[model samples]
Target: MIEVYTDGAANGDPGPSGAGIFIKKGKNNYHYAYPLGILSNHEAEFFAVIQALELCRKEFPEEILSFRSDSKLVVDVIEKGFTKNQKFLPLLQKIQEEAAHFSFFFIKWIPEKQNFHADKLSKKAIHLNKS
Candidate 1:
């Protein structure tokens, strides 16, 4: 099973943002922090999952994937397969598409404390983007 931890942060509600992804498969681990220029926090969160899914598709296609995130909104939206917020429709669609590539995909909401690694990576990306 491939385990993925993801997080996103923004300087403001709709400000500079970044996505952090940590992937673990057996004894291997990978970390990625990407600056997303400017976007809302929710957008950043969705992008983080999108980016992570893309990576999984490239590196671990057809593998069982378990995604963990600190954002309940993202987890809930994906689990429900829909969202009332029209702004996130495109993102939701993208997520669904990406998820279809895997033989098995699961997403869970974790507490912020349990998501420190990805959270820290996201903050570091924000700082890097500022420079």
Candidate 2:
């Protein structure tokens, strides 16, 4: 199974943001980052998971995906079947629908320190997108 780790970072509540993803299979490592505009940290966190899944769909299709993230919102929403914020219901539903295309999917929450690599990538993404 391939393990994919994702995280998001923001400078403030509604500030410069980014999404980071790192995928590991065997000894191979893959990393990606995408800049996000002004939004709540929670929104960026959800975007990170979506971005990670999209990457997997394109690059690692048909493979077993074991996804991990430092965001409690991302992990709990998908894994524990917790209720999502009402504002995000539509997006949450869309993401869930798209995920059906995957052969396998799993999400876990990890400690913040363990997610530093992705955190750095996310911060870099925000910098790259600065105008």
Model 1 has an lDDT value of 0.93
Per-residue lDDT over 1-131 for candidate 1, one digit per residue giving the tens place of the 0 to 100 score: 98999999999989999999988889998889999889899999999999999989998897899999999999999999999899999999999999999889999999999998899888888877888
Off by over 4 Å in 1: none
State the local distance difference test value for candidate 2.
Answer: 0.82
The regions of model 2 sitting more than 4 angstroms off are 82-84
Which candidate's TM-score is highest?
A: 1
Expressed as tens digits, the lDDT of each residue in 95-119 for candidate 2 is 6865787878888899989888788
Count of residue pairs whose backbone atoms collide, per candidate = 0, 0
Worst lDDT run of 10 residues, candidate 1, spans 121-130
10 residues in a row with least lDDT, candidate 2: 80-89
